[model samples]
Target: MADLKGKSRATTTPADGCALCSLPLLVPQEPSSDIEDDEDEETPSHLIDDVELPCGDHFHWDCLMNASKISPVDKLRFCLFCRQQAVTIADDGSEKLLVHVRNEGGLTSNFDLGEEIRSEIAFDSNPHLRRTEAFLSLMSQDDLETAEEMLRGEDGAEPVDPNSTYEEGGLTALHVAAYNNNVRAIELLLRYGAQKDKRSNDGASPLDCASQVEAWNAVQVLNS
Candidate 1:
């Protein structure tokens, strides 16, 4: 089993295919540069070695960084593959997180713009409500990593109640997942103690939310 708090203890080998991009992990080579004295030239992505996520999945370094660019550093501190919380252990026995700056071509670029309008809005007065917003946002984007962290409270943060309702939509995480047609998220929420029959402020169950949105996959998961 992999450790959720820090780097995974699971032994890993350089696999043939990268878990993130599904591309071959070729042997690393020295980056060629015609301008030898140029200080501004960045190292090429292909020159980096394979990187192992805390979940025990191997990915090309560029693929991992590319994936990192999609997630907000403040919200997603876990592995995108297995939703395992990852941390770097300092010499002083404290854990620190190193976040990569966001760039284009990640989840933000592929996500539907209209979906943001429908996402759960956070109330500015309460910081706790941001957790709810984060959960809903993760569900909307199918971001299992941060969602699992919130659900499990693995990092010592307060666990996100699966039945907790957002002030704006008055919807639970399940409802949000259903509305997004996120079957995997629906399953994860259900496994983490979400009640499928729990009603929103408008008397909408998760199934009802899926039905309203024609989220067939979510409906099937909820029904099952």
Candidate 2:
């Protein structure tokens, strides 16, 4: 982990507002002519160390660090605004904020944190399958764009199997969407090749799942 104790003063400020506090960045003063050459060679001074987020916005370094301290471990120091991973794991498994310019590509890469969560759930050895259950929960709660992204794997990562079943009740993404009366999610899943007649572990089809939740619109769509 990067040291968080340093208290260097910021010399330059960002024109755009801080991503965290939304306050204007502190501007640095012009170099003084009377300063000695040795003093000029000393560590540079700044009003705030503007750290760029994965979403391309910037935040004060201290603000970023404070956010990281309160975020969940699974999120892995994600951006407060965009929810993109803002930290990287070192070779020794230590987590550190990717603050250097060379590490910027990791922020801009096509990797999807949501896909990472899915993979982790699929590979988990625990019999309870809590992660898988959470993945299904997300399917019901996520917005249209997020639902489509997970189904289509728009981040260029391996697409999650649309037919993959939840270990608890063998419910697929389509079944969850139907139960929630999510018409757009249903459309996206159908377009992505989800089987309309596929049965769950309880022998319930997507229509059955919809009916259980009183999703009449989903039933009509499935009936068609």
Best by TM-score: 1
lDDT of 1 by residue, 28-111 (tens): 446566757456875544422355544455555566545544555433356667777755666996554433211211111121
- For candidate 2, give the lDDT of residue 113: 38
Off by over 4 Å in 2: 1-137
TM-scores, each model vs. reference: 0.43, 0.41
Give candidate 2's error at residue 109 in angstroms: 39
lDDT of 2 at 68: 44
* Root-mean-square deviation (CA) per prediction: 18.1, 16.1
Give the alpha-carbon lDDT of every model: 0.62, 0.63
Candidate 2 local lDDT, 1-224, one digit each (tens): 12233233333345787778887555364666897668447634434445564557776545654554455445646767777876677699866554421121122222333334334444554523543354456676766566567556674555656777876788898998899888878887888788999999989999999999899999988888
After the best TM-score superposition of candidate 1, give how far the Cα of residue 67 lies from its true spot, in angstroms.
Answer: 38
